[model samples]
Target chain A: MPKTKAVDLVVVGAGPAGMAAAVAAAEAGVEKIILLERQAELGGILPQCIHNGFGLRYFKEELTGPEYAHRFVQELKKHPGLKVKTETMVVTITPDRKVVTTSATEGLVCYQAGAVILAMGCRERPRGAINIPGTRPAGIYTAGSLQYLMNIEGFLPGRSAVILGSGDIGLIMARRLTLEGVRVKAVLELMPYSNGLNRNIVQCLEDFQIPLYLSHTVTEIFGEKRVEKVRVAPVDKDFKPIAEKGFDLSCDTLVLSVGLIPENELSLQIGVELDPATGGPVVDSFYQTTVEGIFACGNVALVHDLVDDVSTESALAGRAAAAYLKGEIKTKRWLPVKAGRNIRSIVPQRIVVGQTTPLYIRARYPERNATLHVGDGQTKQQVVSPGETIYYTLKPEDIRTADGWVEVSLEGGRVHD
Target chain B: MTELTCIVCPVGCRLKVEQGKEGLKIIGNGCRRGVAYARDEMTAPKRMLTAVVQVAGSERMLPVKTETAIPKAKIYAAMEEIKAITVSPPVMIGQVIKENLAESGVPLVATGTIAGEGCFKPLEKSLGSE
Candidate 1:
């Protein structure tokens, strides 16, 4: 026998986003809201992250990942309308707003929500996501998995390691492994520039004497049962590996930190529209997805640079969902937003007219002394990198001016415009 | 000219520290904080060491971090000292797990609380695939 319950809102994944959303909905007077997480604890990846760079924007202080998550998780306990279910796996989501989940304690449970907030976050791109000719070895792992192994499990992956992709996690791991007395041989990135923050590149790589090779990639992996050595090669502009200038290095492990893909099986089940650039569901302002009452925020909607940003975005979704349940938000036509020049993508793909909206964007390339102009509002930035998210506030004046859609374009700093 | 990028914020201004008879002069920093960061980078750098320490009553490891950053050179030594340590029940947040870790005079404090009773089991499963 299964129990089907009705809830005002069902928020998925109890990471920063889901927790924040559920709490916000509760604060907004939504009487029945449930938060679901597969992890045994409420914090999600925060427990393993253990890094101290989080919560600068939201909390106005540098906090470790666990600390940042606890702030919301503690508050979530006080919300009367919110119910948190940890160790619960949501198996399916239907178009009619039904969430089917299975848990050890609550076996075969279903919740019909007035609105569904998808905040399942993201996952690292594994070996299969990319084509690297290699042996199926035991030591291959994603940077995040390696982090969990080392940080939470108290087990180092290997004695020495070679990390592919100099993203934030890989760079942080280089320093972390060194601190743990594990020899990090090198960090290789296929792109000419690193995709991690400038501070991370300096503090994690430069401080540790770790070499970061640009435009380089692992060509082949050589090992019978465990990773023994890897062949490295330089690549051309088109990212085609060149063999002539290739090299080889022996290492016990290979860690991939290439990229993150939003976990969207449930969202797909509901047939929500996804943006190809973000690899998550597309939404208008208020973080409301194309589906009328369905909403999404955090990495499930778009990959944010900071956990603080995730909490901020998820709060809007929660508040808006509560409003939707209370019949407060008036349904209206949504105007789309576009990435004009030197801009990769903009979140909240659409915006509401006559409303103030905060737009999130990233440059397609490295830019210095750049001004991002969206409609009439312009903010000058000292520098903008693909690793960091650039936030622009569209004032009510900017929204009232004219057009149906807003165009975000980066001006100055070698944009070729 | 010793140049270092200030890691305090995302701006990451390349700061120039010129040592002269008049003492140290920092240039190219975006703000006053950047100037301070250059001074520390040029001098002794410090880092807050964060790791997990086993709790006697709980199955999950309690997350511990230095109350303040320790000298950068002392991090590895600190990790070695932390590995052998464990604490018993009712571990409060900010409770010092190890005092003067690595002899740096900085205590390793707990970041997560482990309840005295009704303990939660640690996650033993391997990292899940996406």
Candidate 2:
């Protein structure tokens, strides 16, 4: 007996940060809103991400993940106070914002909202979270479930492959399983620089020549039910695995792409406050989240290397959950932000001191001209990377009224010395 | 010298290219499209191809792209002419489907939209934690 209904803004996962936070909370007027989506449609994995470098800065053109989710599902069909559902599924959100969902023509439903915008977008780390030893096979997958079985079920998950983690969806499925004829060969990676995006390692593996290797990995995973081979190796710089400089590599599919995890189990069922270095949800500067009216933006709230910055951070968490459901938000006074020196993560882990926010940041290594700073404001970057994501804004004279914590850092670099 | 990187955007910009003395120079480009992407990576290097086609009766595929960049050595003959054409739906997002494709004159289109055959409902499963 679940039938509830309430609403004023629900938004959970329609992807591309829940259709840009339900079209910016129905263009910030947020009458009823709703938006769920457990995928039956509504561009979540941007329609199985058919690639083409998605929207260059919010549709400044270049689109393709289903034309950047068909321009936000056509502006969420011009909001009639928005109500999209699609295959449904939410399954409990409750911290008093309720939600519940599940569908097959509405089998269970519940809502009671008034704010909640979590946009559950992220997840793809599988292969039992990277333990990868061997045997239990069937040709591994998870370069986003083989890019959703080759771009949304036309199905074709193998025929010579090896890819492991050069990210950017294992370098765009090593050029989409080499333009669908497969035979990809090697992409490996355990870091040595290449958490993807250097123009996806120069257009998806140096434009189809494949073999990226880098610090290499894979160290064992033969066949039995259908994998055939894979031993590869070569890590040592502290990454270890140099077992006789291993090497096996026969193939029949393996994929992986190795990262992204920000689905925050419904933002940990309402306790919220999470940012264990960007596993996401710990917000401020209007993306809200430490659980007030409950808000979160793209990639659950952090893993954004761009989908045009997850449609500009889920359209500012759909206008900050429609200005916190129209109480028109005010509370203020936060300011923590940290992550200094060679920084690794920093998404609004609390901000507000004078307002202007943006922040993001994320460089744990790789620099060029560097110098980011942010507590007293600074900017320089002519190249910086933990695989890109620096963006800064912070002004209000960069925390002048400084209540204390602000950090951010990155500092010096070469610039051709 | 030679280096490269500038995949047009996402601020990749590494560039370097050399031969100076008045000809190709380039060098850590931050813009000018990385000096026309290092003068089209030393001559002729196009890209934008995107794929997925099969959609006649529908095991559904549709996606598509190109209406522009192609010759990165004709992307496997434009994915074997977009894996042997199939489109029969009301399919319209930019429509086209294949005009000069592998000939590299461009035209391939359809960045998604389909509406034919039982309209697809079966393959949804795989939602996270794969």
DockQ for candidate 2: 0.23
Best by TM-score: 1
lDDT of 2 at A278: 86
Q: List the DockQ of the predictions in order.
A: 0.34, 0.23
Candidate 1 residue A360 C-alpha distance from true site, Å:
1.0
Give stretches of model 1 more than 4 Å off: A415-417, B9-14, B18-32, B56-59, B116-130
Looking only at chain B, model 2 earns a TM-score of: 0.38
For model 1, residues A99-174, the per-residue Cα lDDT tens digits are: 9999887789999899999999999999988889978888998999998877766687888899999988899888
Query: What is the TM-score of each candidate's chain B when compared with the real chain B?
Result: 0.79, 0.38
lDDT of 2 by residue, A211-248 (tens): 78788889788988899988999889898888897989
The CA lDDT at A128 in model 2 is 81
Structural similarity to truth (TM-score) of each candidate: 0.94, 0.39
lDDT scores for all predictions?
Answer: 0.84, 0.81
